[model samples]
Target: MNKLLIALLVFLFFSCAKESDSVAKKRITDEVFVPTLKIDSTDLLGLPKDTGGIHKGYLLNETEAVYAHMIYTPGGYQESGEGYPLLIFLHGWGPRQLTNEIGTDLNVVKEHGPPALIEQKQWNPSFPFIVASPQLEGQYWASADVHSFIDYIIEKYNINTNRIYLTGLSLGGGGCWYYVGEKGEESHAAAIIPISARGEASIVSNLTNTPIWAFHGAKDQTVEPINNYGSVTMVNEINRNSPAVIAKVTVFDNAGHDAWTRTYGNQFGETGISYSPFNLNIYDWLLQYKKE
Candidate 1:
């Protein structure tokens, strides 16, 4: 009888756990996400499997531990030529990994974001620059690695220090915000564009000296649009007391959680034309700013 009871209790526990997980997934889908689903499970996203510029790379931290990454260099870029602008992109959450094929890390090294744009031919190679996207193993960006990697790339690639920029979407966006706040001054970043993600509200004060162009979907559920607004509002308030800062929140109406579609794709409306300074279809604006 005791053996039967023990077996019954185990079954009940597993059943409850399964139901709980389903409910949690449903809540995320129903409340936070739309009905349909389209995300890379393999995380083999970003550049085409054949795309040449992007190569798998890794960075070593103070402990000499390796952090895997995806790196992209614009075409015709030469190490001996004038230095290229550097853009350090951070990626969002990938599908849970099934095996550790790529590395022992928890997340798959997706070729998404900047790498995807360049690989898919969405980003013009004429915009000469270097993009290094580090696949993080956690929910958010790490400042220590961010600082170390940027320094490493700048030194190794002869990147124009004045033209270094930062940008990311969702988890990456939040990471960008966090990094800019914590180490923007130290890193000497030219600007940052965070989409559908914002860090601590109070962190805005720390970025009065940084140019920020934040984007968010009005109907987003995963991360509220107000987060970006809060950062912009706070920056504006603080700007009034110091050197005026440039921070804008570009809102996408009737848009879902995937603000990145327009953010990185630079697609605004049917024409993909500039709707406002907020919604831009070009990358020159980012290049407009350079550290003095």
Candidate 2:
């Protein structure tokens, strides 16, 4: 009789475990695997494949005028139904003429091609996301038009609102500060990475609830390292007032206005600034934060 009782107990335990496993699987399927909106050709530029090559052109030309280009990498579309995160990149000044070669300029394209993160097939197929690169018009910053473009992309591609990210260099860096300070909540970006640009201290108060990671070159001459002081100081003050926000400021010694080169380029080896490594770092950092 004891042997029969023991066998019955083992069967009951396994039955309970199977039922619990089924419930957990159902929850994950219902919550995490919901179908996201499908992306069409009109939704994004560039060819179908992630490594087809970079697509360049004017995304939006309005009264103010905004010229931009983008690179799209759809994850294993057949494997995942959920939408992917989006990363918007704002470029610094380019040639005034807007020549064809301007799209491939060293400063603009440096570390952005060949082995770029966006071009990697492994990362593209597994972690599908859209990358937008906008080059501002003459004397115009990426503040106004880039923000609108971001909204357009989000609506068009059905982007996962929780995973949006922003990054820039030099003038673009300044624009990052401007955009995040002004319309960050509207964009709903997970985080902002501003390289070598100083944002307004007044705006820091507004971003006390936002996640921001700023990088600057200690020896920067063009924008100057002191420019970052105001933003950093404001961040500290705001954090003191409200300790809930997560803000980090990193200064690279012996670096200059080209801090993006180090921040974006591979840290293990010396290479010109590229988006591969920096993209990885920013995405990893961004995953930790989510909209409430």
Candidate 3:
């Protein structure tokens, strides 16, 4: 009898110990091992379908000799998985090289503050808009490669197809006119903003339905305010044909060729620059239009 009782007690102790070990192993597996198997949604490298998006810079060849830098902004919609708006910015004159121009002339850090500073300001992380700042190849103008880059972003990002915005400065201003007047009417931009330059007057015939907001420095030296003759003259001509197009011009008296500082420097600390009335106004103006 004594032997049997001792055997029974030993069996019970071993069984309980085994059960405790099993429970501990199960708990550890549940807590640590399982999460490793599950995929993280924020992993940008992971190719899980629509798991996380990306923002990147691309170099594109528009023609045989023309290549440009494309700055892509991805959408942050958690549920919809829909396409987003696009903003294509054409840089003025600098080096013909795409990366050099981007690093120097179109340096977002110099002009619009650093990316980290921008994020610290709580600007929309997923602004859902792509901005391509294509440097003109050689002595080329925005007319040569601007539209092609725009088309590329439209195709590559699978953009919203409806909402597009075009902006530029100096020579790019002239390019803006070339776009809206010559090619952009039927293109996709909801509105066009050109600073310190104007396109040919003859091209205004097709711009009757497009909205134009032009900025010029009264003191501009590189492209004089007198060039307004081309811009205002074209808008007037367009109005004569169709009064529907919304076209207006704004001139800053004390400004110069760098009217872009006023044009894009709005939003308070948006660019780490002092607030300019011009910047605030332009930002408000741009938000009013979206592609139909």
What's the lDDT for all of these models?
0.64, 0.57, 0.56
**In candidate 2, residue 25 scores what lDDT?**
92
Better of 1 and 2 by lDDT: 1
Q: What digit string (tens of lDDT, one per residue) describes model 3 on residues 101-174?
A: 44453344223311222234422422334455555656546454666667766666556566577877776777
Model 1 TM-score, 2 decimals:
0.69
**Model 1 regions more than 4 Å off:** 1-54, 57-66, 95-100, 103-111, 227-243, 270-279
Worst 10 residues of 1 by lDDT: 39-48
Cα deviation at 11, candidate 1, in Å, is: 90
Best by TM-score: 1
The residue ranges of model 3 lying beyond 4 angstroms of the native Cα positions read: 1-55, 60-66, 74-80, 98-128, 142-144, 228-237, 267-284, 290-292
Models 1 onward score TM values of 0.69, 0.64, 0.63
Residue-by-residue lDDT tens digits, candidate 1, 3-94? 99999999999999999999998865553332342212221122222334544545334223334566677655567646777888877776
Candidates ranked, most accurate by lDDT first: 1, 2, 3
Q: Candidate 2, residues 101-204: lDDT per residue as tens digits?
A: 54453235334421245544323322345666655556645456677777777665646667677877767777777776777456566677777776666666
Which candidate ranks first by lDDT, i.e. highest?
1
Global Cα lDDT for candidate 2: 0.57
**Residue 102's lDDT in candidate 2:** 43
